[model samples]
Target: MNQQPVEGFSKLSKQRKIDWLIKEYLSDDRSYEQILQQYWNGDAILQKLHEEFSENTISNFYMPYGIAPNFLIDGKLLALPMAVEESSVVAAASKAAKFWIDKGGFKTTIINTKKLGHTHFIINVEPHKLQHFFNFKLKKRLFEATEEITKNMRNRGGGILNIRLIDKTADLENYFQLKASFDTVDSMGANFINSCLEQFGKTLTEEVAKDETFTPEEKDSLQIVMNILSNFTPDCIVRAEVSCKIEDLKDDSGISNEEFATKFKRAVTIAEIEPFRATTHNKGIMNGVDAVVIATGNDFRATEACAHAYAAKDGKYTSLTHCTIDGGVFRFWIDLPISVGVVGGLTNLHPLVKFSLALLGKPSAQELMSILAVSGLAQNFAAIRSLVTTGIQKGHMKMHLLNILNQLGATEEEKNHFVTYFKDKTVTHHEVISQFNSLRAQ
Candidate 1:
């Protein structure tokens, strides 16, 4: 529980300062709210974002991860905000972000704000009578249901903006589709839309009672199969931009910054239009976002689904994040559908979430969103950094050596020796044993 900052970090930039402080000290600090307030000029941003939105319907999740200090992304300091659970995500992001920070912080811009609408229902219509059920009442029932769903949303800043009916069948088939656009404020509106569908399904069944064309047996035979939540959560949208300087892309690999950026851009290009490549491309972004997701206890599954879906939402598989070098600066951007929250559900129940939120001092959804954007960019850099300079195995192996040594109950001297040996790129059990023996002899 040392309050002292990481040694030599004073020479780091402001973004580095925040990164080191959060990574090392936050685990011990009782609250990050104080740190964010003391450093980032208070939680004013959080206040503003929440002031414009309602928490009653939406929840926001926030995770503060360390973005290595001294980052110069497009010549800007990036306070990378990551929402993910796995370790090394923030570290990877920070490493990548730092690579760009020296040139200029990752130049990122958001694209649009879209939302998903979910509906759950229970129907009571005869199986055979279903053929005669297509009427104006069905359309009316949907409108009425959408109106109800949009009622509170409109008042609070969101409403049913649009509705679409997709037909899964054109002929005498039982499957039908009813989709509505409800502007859910801030968070994913799965709960809200489902409630609306429950009512609509019941009303539709009741309306069938008045149909003279259907006999009593027909009406009795009708029943609702799956009046549950709909998966057509194709509503949210996101976009970002980041750029790095050519001079700052340097590493020990000796690849000139420009050359490296070119190679990295080529890799990114290959990732585009290739599902095999795009999956890894998007995985890097998720590394950052998922960290915050686990930190805040949101539904990581749903968030991930929407993200991948968004990547190919246009019917073509492609990278959600884009990287390039423009005007002598390396640029990175990611557009993803991230439906997460900072309040509600387990954001309060989970112990780590509350602790992380307290450490963050309560950030606004937009601020949190911005931070997530940076994390995505940073993660992209990390992958490219590994490919362009040091192979991915080098640093990872060194880190893993420490864990392995710890697991083996090696003494501090023995562990340090193993770490040094591994860093030298000589990773063999024999070498590890030799070092351990030498340490014991000493």
Candidate 2:
């Protein structure tokens, strides 16, 4: 039976917390306690930093940090850092990168980099009057109020792009918005944008209270519901593509490059039109995207939420990747709505995250967006090619071979023998176990 919940869990020392956890939940197992201690960092300062990253701290959870090399993006060769536990992701990305390098490699264009936020409020007022007051009376004051906060951003060539007073009374009673856009430059700008928005919220309340146009009731009825930034950056888009002569593609699955192009295009089209397939299709793309995002210490959850939302922005969930073949040339691309930073949050703190940024040659936010979009495109191509040709299971199961060997407690000699033995053989959990048992008995 589970023990009752304890209060002030956060207040407990790390050791005490571990003690309580083991006693209450782990049956006081010293082995489980040792597992946690073994994962702790050797450096006290670094461990303290990790502890402070979240509340109710525990030992660090580790993920394999793998490299996807030979990525020639926009003519520069880079080996991307991908952090994921999934067995085949890094291998697939590397294979795709090498395949495209001989072709044109990955090319990208930054369409826009505008991010937005809203100060949501409720106000019972005449719509036309409210709009009129915003136009002549309150607009200048809003900008003036945030000048100090935005001064540094403006000096850096990025600041408030625009602000508008939106009317949404048709959807809900007394609901409206102060929608504003920003250019945050090289950082993700979540904090900067939110700070500006909070100021907007305060300025709105103060201005409304003091303005003669609002009247007493209008002033009192105005309620600032929230001041927050939106992760849905629809306008922030980057396009990454790989194009090559159809004949340049190498297919060993008994299919011509021409046939491969047609089938691959068809697969992509199905994802674009069908919701069910699109979900899994985009998930595969994110298998590459989220890995890079996490490795660089960016927020994969925010990145994922924005991407999935962008996929369905047309009112239906669909693929973020596309494919085309025209005039003897095959092209694959993804217009990914991804926003990432290279100079803030964990970028400045985590050691491995700093290494990832350095390994990518310290990309700006826009450049990082291009890299991320290209990663997704590369992964989608690899997946589609497999689905249309040899099948996803063959390579995936082969990658699972190592995990299986570990699970069956195979010795080093047995592992080496089985790895060679399975070079041309199909790998399944049962088959591995059976083969290992047979080898051991012999």
Candidate 3:
């Protein structure tokens, strides 16, 4: 469809944008206007606050916020809040949490907590000279120059940790990188790290211009390309694990414990060896990770990017998790580079986010990383257990039945009837419509 740009779309009032959208796209359908209003907050103050969250606010989008309790991580029981619209994700995590609670639950360890940023520049100078320029004296001077920016972060026990010069001339002529590491403490630190990088870029340019060691060509060639924090934080990593004896792996799937363990391990092996399978495997893990991350008002996009990148760090895409049965003990675990924050962003501003953090006992950044990793591990375990046993559709379809019923506009009575009707039957959209039609006919 051909469309014309609406000038000053963002400057329009909230209602004005809605009116424009309805006129242009809805063809003057008044029903959508009501639908949009239906999701608005009942309180005027809350609704106004929500409108300010973004530009051109039309309506509030909502996802089911659920809690998965009995997560005994590091001897602490926690009820993790998860915001997701997927049918079976919360159910799967809850089931895994209960199953592992008796099996010593989950153990988590923080491997590293340093975030990364880069300052890319081009300098037509010898590699030795470039290396010498980033020497101890200059590095100290650079850190000192950013003291004004780093002062607050340092007071909070987080600041610029290290600055190193990286030679990338092999890829592009005269290309070099000024890579930095930071301890952001409790915050996600995107803005802080970027601010520091910009300051560093300015300092580098000024310092090079003043140095008598560089010719005009070398000084002029020092052009900063960009300064930004990297979402691929390999150094910010955590590990979560759950282990139990192979003989203890019993369930209603009718598979023997030993056979189940063997099959589970095999499924993980396939994900490890096959990129196609690994992608979906990792996505299942993210279902749990992202839910908790979003619930706590953290950046799920950055967390997901870092995780997928870490999965491919071995030069081939593979699962973010691993499983093994050794000495009659079955163990499933994941080592992932997950960067999340307990403070900053929407954690304090959003009401639901604050509630979710409070529900988590207000963990530190490191503790939040552990909780998120465990959530992913739990979700992966539940998914693989289903995949190797009764197949994923049985339980998923059962949970998805409500969505189908709701879509058909089934009455509460009819929905109640079908809920029991499809308990042991496979659910399909066609079957649901057929049943709804049959019920209506009667």
Q: How well does candidate 1 score on lDDT at residue 78?
A: 37
lDDT (10s digit) by residue, model 1, range 1-442: 6566357754665445555666676774536645454543236565444423432212244434443444443344434334544445666766665555545455444354455443323233443344345444465666675575667677878765654444444343544445556555554566776776666567656766777876787566555544454333454444556554677656667877677778878888988868998898788777767766666556768767777876787898788777767788777677666665666666666556676656555654444455556666667768767876776666555545665666668978776666666665645555666676677778
Model 3, 163-229: lDDT tens digits are 9999999999999998999999999999999999998899899999999999998898889999999
Tens digits of lDDT, candidate 2, 145-194: 99998998899889999999999999999999999999999888999999
Superior candidate under TM-score, 1 versus 3: 3
Q: Model 3 reaches what TM-score against the true structure?
A: 0.97
lDDT of 2: 0.92
Error of 2 at 294 (Å): 1.0
Ranking the candidates on lDDT from highest down gives 3, 2, 1
From the highest TM-score down, the ranking of the candidates is 2, 3, 1
Stretches of candidate 3 exceeding 4 Å from the true structure = none
Candidates' C-alpha lDDT: 0.60, 0.92, 0.92
Off by over 4 Å in 2: none
Pairs in steric clash, model 2? none
